[model samples]
Target chain A: MAPVTMIEAIREALDEEMQRDPAVVLIGEDIGVYGGAFKATEGLLAKYGWERVIDTPISETAIIGAAVGMSYQGLRPVAEMQFMDFIACCFNQMVNFVAKSHYRWGGPVPMVVRGPCGGGVHGGPFHSQNPEMWFVHTPGLKVVCPSTAYDAKGLLKSAIRDNNPVLCLEHKFLYRRVKEELPAEDYTVPIGKLAVRRTGRDLTIATYGAMTLHTLEAAEELAMEGIEAEVLDLRTLAPLDREGILESVRRTHKLLVVHEDVKTGGVAGEIAATVNEQAFEELDGPVLRVTSLDAPVPFSPPLEEHFLPQVADVTRAARELARY
Target chain B: MELPEMKYPLSREQLLDLYYFMRLTRELDEQLVRLFRQNKVVGGLYSSIGQEATSVGTAYTLEKRDWMAPMIRNVGGLLVKGFRPRDILMQYMARSGSPTGGKDGTSHFGDLQERHVVSPISMLGDLIPVMTGVAMGGRYLGQKLVTMTWIGDGGTSTGAFHEGMNLAAAQRAPFVCVVENNQWAYSTPVARQVPLHDLAERARAYGIASYVVDGNDVVAVYQTTKEAVERARRGEGPALVESKTMRMKGHAQHDAAVYVPPEMFEYWKARDPIARYETWLTERKVWDKKTKAEIERRIERELKEELEFAENSPLPEPEVAERGVYCEGCHTIEARWERPIEQLQPPKASVQAAWTVSDFGGTNGGGAAAKAHAPEAAEETKPAAVAAKAAAVSTRGANGGTKRSARAAARPKRRR
Candidate 1:
């Protein structure tokens, strides 16, 4: 009934899912007693107890690998990475095993690896990261980055219920920043559907996660200048809502993608290429992107601020595209 | 410890069964090698030649509920766990009807539900954590099951080995980590791989009970693994069993093993597990020449039937490649995006103006949400200035200064 923070929404989703399904469990460092580095999993241990909310050692390989094994035994495990930057440690497990298990053997790994991702929190290279592209490039994995609390809860519920391994990337910047009134009744946002956060006519700003907020701000700023910019939230990266993206681009005839991940090899490039291949005739201007610099997330506030794409950056990109 | 006086833990029938399994595995390895040489096999064959005892012995001790994560050299273990030889042959032949559905050939085969086996990942030691988690999940679910996973001597050097073992030990998971220290990790010998003489000693770092057994002795391996499995089922936590054997052949059929020391090969060859077990069985009067001949003939007939089945199995259709990349009911991003753009929903008009920080609840919320952004921060900086700074940074393009040539130039010159 009331608006809840993204972190709270995530916590509620885990809490409700564990209650709904006995097979659902939680495993991660400091997740049980410490709540979590960001407290996304706060009160989960207290609610579900230790057996369901397991506190694992600081071993990402073991955490992910064990989650894969647990999935084989019919248990739905939601493993937290504390911070998404550390997920690189278990890259082999995720890329080689978890991502390939379904394709390799037709086995369904009903597991979710959720954690606070994205820069802007000044967590440096080790804590702040938008590594969704890594898993997006990997097949057999569903990647989700919800911008609002409602989507955070709904998408997580869907991810937990889905048979494939899903990477739920929560932006650290939006954990407490984004809040929305959620329905009391249980609901799940389908993994492949795109949410049209704000509709417009002149141009389309296709983005997700924290960038959605900045892009929305940019859209509002452009709207004052008589430019109606549509904001499309790509809730799920892998199994991307291609229909939503193409349709928005077709109407606006202009596209500007935004993301917090590094520009090189980011989802922005993929979207640009897709539009270029499928809707090249509709485009009145070149597809553009406002993404982080191609470098590790700097720890200093100023450097991180410069490294990350801001509202002003999106506004500049959207205005330039609107003119064309 | 000295080799225990060939005590029989199993009855005559079980012993005969074990002997038959070992003989069958040995024959299969020989057949695979011959097939590979004749250019009939699809992939490189990695045999369990001298290490059949280790696989058969440990796998035989596992109950139906227990799971075994085997490596390429654990075909014997797979067979002992009730994996039909014909299915294994079908897998190697890359038939559509194979368990892997021609997805993976050779030792990359497993049946999680039917056979209780976790499919192997080629990145050695990775399966250790997987097996540990399976056991931990089993214990948590109130199932009385023990999980055993195999790794090579070289695998112990990996970071995953330590992580998996430490997790298993700390969690007190019902896991048995079997390190098949068959001396060589590919071409690298154990002596060169680690400074320590015994790999079992590494387990002490995790504070788990460890044992080193004579891998060449089937009875010793079975007895050692049985005790470890019993301890695990008793909730005593994980144990490390190092089966010290040697790789008598090259890593795979492609390798001629010219690098191997002739004397070293001869030494391990003299102590072949199958030959030693045959002698032990004959001495105990549990097996005779007539029984051995009959068993060999039976295995030969079975091998012929399996070969025919593999030959008769059809090759997968070309379209099958696009399938099985994801599980059934799973929709890949590529598949969804492949649809034509015009058929999708038409974009709608904007419902509102630009969104502001306040809309995200800077004032409406309290505590962390309220203090989420520093007050007056927006007024302090101009949007034009920030946009200018961002534009300046964006000009550098995605490839920054980490060019390959630059990195190579930074490397120190090597000494001749």
Candidate 2:
């Protein structure tokens, strides 16, 4: 109904959910009168009041720890780790307490933790990172990295509504840069389901979060070279959409995995292995991946471009698959 | 406040709770040893066999609402924390009916909604953060409640211990961080966990208060704990109370204590705190030989009851194995307490499907049939940030609930 930035759509989702469910509360730093650092929580404090839209101290541990306790006590608290990179600060709370809560205690930690993750701007290594693989490795945690305004709004709403703990990684680069006409009314996107963003036959490009946008761009560009790339936006990471992945792989008979995370130990490695194990026969070329180099994302603009996976890299990988 | 002095002598009732629980610990320990021999209780047990007074004295003083996190070795702490001896037995065997429904082993215990007694776990001092969070609950809720967590001298080596105390002290949270310093940590001793002479000294780092007591002396432990709890209730933050005692048994059932040198072992046994307390009470004419004999006999009987009950209890059913994993009951924040979906959907539907499908989406629903992933519009991610917000102000604060804020800013602005 309205063409909104990914930021407003998320703010709308939070405002609406908070309005519909009194049990839904927000816990993060500077989310109150200050709004969010990115203003995703704009007007929330004035609308819901501070009691509902709390601004916490700069303690990720406290944010996540409080979320765990709040979730335990029946509040669907949405905890935000300001920058995804700083998540290492509360690694134990996330991996040990929140993630393991369900499997460890047979309790559902029905809380959603959303944050600005991934780097495309000159935010540097410290600020700009797609650290999805960390939580992806954890069992109880459900990781979602949304690249579109639609997926961002829908998934944020769904993650909040889900009965389990979910981590929604909003690519920092996509927050303002991305725009789409989102549904005016309420909506929710179920987690653990992959989306087929564009149809193709030559090769399958599996990616998520910010990388989804890049892969799509690469797909459109690859079309000029007579290669059709079927792009699978793996919105959910932990519960990888293997069937969707295999289907695309089976159809194209080739796979080209892409992600912003470093190549080694990224989501691509797991998917490639799974395809090898489950859909080994459905192959024409080797499963290739275009990912960030193992080196930390450089702070310099030009160097950082070389450091991360760009549209060209995805295109090159797809071209190779097309040739094979 | 005097160095190693007892305030009020432990009373008959207090003594009985301690003695009986100690006896429960004793019988449970003996049973584990037998079980080990029989191969029933797997893994070497970390029993509170000898250090019974330490666990019982601290836990018995806690009111029903006082939350506790016992260390792995503190079986007495679990038993004394109102965990039925049967629950303990079921837990040791990892049965489903046990508090952890057999999902956890002998140590990992928990039942959060109940009187906050969490089972002892072994990331060493990991429970400290949970304990601190519980204290945060007390502070936020404006309750006189205190969270008491038992850690071993060995647990001092863990980061959680420091993180928990630091946070508690910084927030002035109500917490009694008890260090059951029974001389040895799995045969390594205090010299290993820390170089400091006393674990109590570590409190200086957190800026919380500290107290050291004879863990074996029930009166001393009770007195020290009372002071810590009182200080904690005063919002003075947390206390690092180090109860220096001796390990009566090895780390667990099979430990021959080969690492413990004979001379040091003899010295610790010579100063056994329980026996010393018994003699002190007797010489004061508070308890005579016949009375002491009767108390021991009474504890023995109670121990028998707890053991038999535990041994006889049924194992948990398999179907509900995933029940409390993350607390489906978290949805219950009201009188009717419907799931978020139930609140929005037709009420009649919830009633009809109550027994079959869970409140959330069906487990077996294909992405196609499921509401979110059906070949329709791609679902957005809010964790799904539900665009359909709930009514802003219904049942905001009731029950033992605390309201920190209405809408806590949950996430950052998406950086375009």
Question: Which numbered prediction scores highest in DockQ against the true structure?
Answer: 1
User: Candidate 1 on B93-134: residue-level lDDT in tens?
Assistant: 788878878888887777777688888888988998999888
Candidate 2 lDDT by residue in tens digits, A1-324: 658999988998898897787667787877766778899887776565433555565667667765665565456789877888888887887887777666655545778888898877889878988788898898778888887888898999888888788899998888998898977778888787899999988889998888888888888899987888899999999677888898888888899899889998998999999999988888988999899999888899999999999898888778877887
Q: Against the true two-chain complex, what DockQ does each candidate achieve?
A: 0.17, 0.07
For model 1, the superposed segments whose C-alpha errors exceed 4 Å read B1-8, B330-416
Q: Weakest 10 consecutive residues, lDDT, candidate 2 chain B? A: B390-399
lDDT for B239 in candidate 2 is 73
Question: What's model 2's lDDT at B180?
Answer: 83
Candidate 1: deviation at residue B230, Å?
0.7
